[model samples]
Target: MATADTMLQTALREPARRLTLDLRAVTFFDSAAIHAVVRVAERFPGTLAVLPSRQVRRVLEISGLASQDWFDPS
Candidate 1:
């Protein structure tokens, strides 16, 4: 969670219009991590794209976050 927040903070400091998070290697993540990602996406709006792992996908689905507009699977 802390690590994800730190990474997101650093990434947001950059001047990119879009942020693509390739979370395919992340096999495990808790709600805190999900919260961090969702916060970032909320801050950036349509600029967030998430390529989530199967586990992450399940978590998002279970958390009802997968239906969010910012949860781009592609």
Candidate 2:
């Protein structure tokens, strides 16, 4: 959670820069991590796509957030 928060903080520090979360190597995607991603996306006002691994895609589907525009289930 802290790491995700730090990601958000970094994004906040550079609002003009685009942010992309590369979760292609992440084998675990918990609710807390999802929440952190959500919080970060909420603050950013544009398309915030995340490159998700299969494991992350499963979690996102289970969380019912798979359909969200920010997540790429590739």
Candidate 3:
């Protein structure tokens, strides 16, 4: 989770209109990971696109974060 947070922070430092996070390879995540994702989404709004794995998707759904426009299941 610390590594993920560091990576996300490093990525967000750059300027981009859209940031697509391919999380299909991520099989597990905790609240800290979810918090980081939400922070990015809040900071960038529609600019964050998430390709979540089944587990990640479930976390988002349970947390109600899946309803956000930035969470793209496709």
Q: Please report, in order, the local distance difference test score of every candidate based on alpha carbons.
A: 0.82, 0.76, 0.85
Q: For candidate 1, write residues 1-74 as lDDT tens digits.
A: 65787867876787788888888888788977887887788778988888888898899999999997767666
> Highest TM-score among the candidates is held by which one?
3
Tens digits of per-residue lDDT for model 2, 19-52: 7888898887676788878876786647587888
TM-score for each candidate, following the candidate numbering: 0.86, 0.78, 0.89
Which runs of model 2 end up more than 4 angstroms from their true locations? none
- For model 1, the local distance difference test gives 0.82
Candidate with top lDDT is 3
Model 1 has a clash total of: 0
lDDT of 3 by residue, 16-66 (tens): 888888889998888888888878887788788999999999999999989
Candidate numbers, best lDDT first, in rank order:
3, 1, 2
Error of 3 at 39 (Å): 1.0
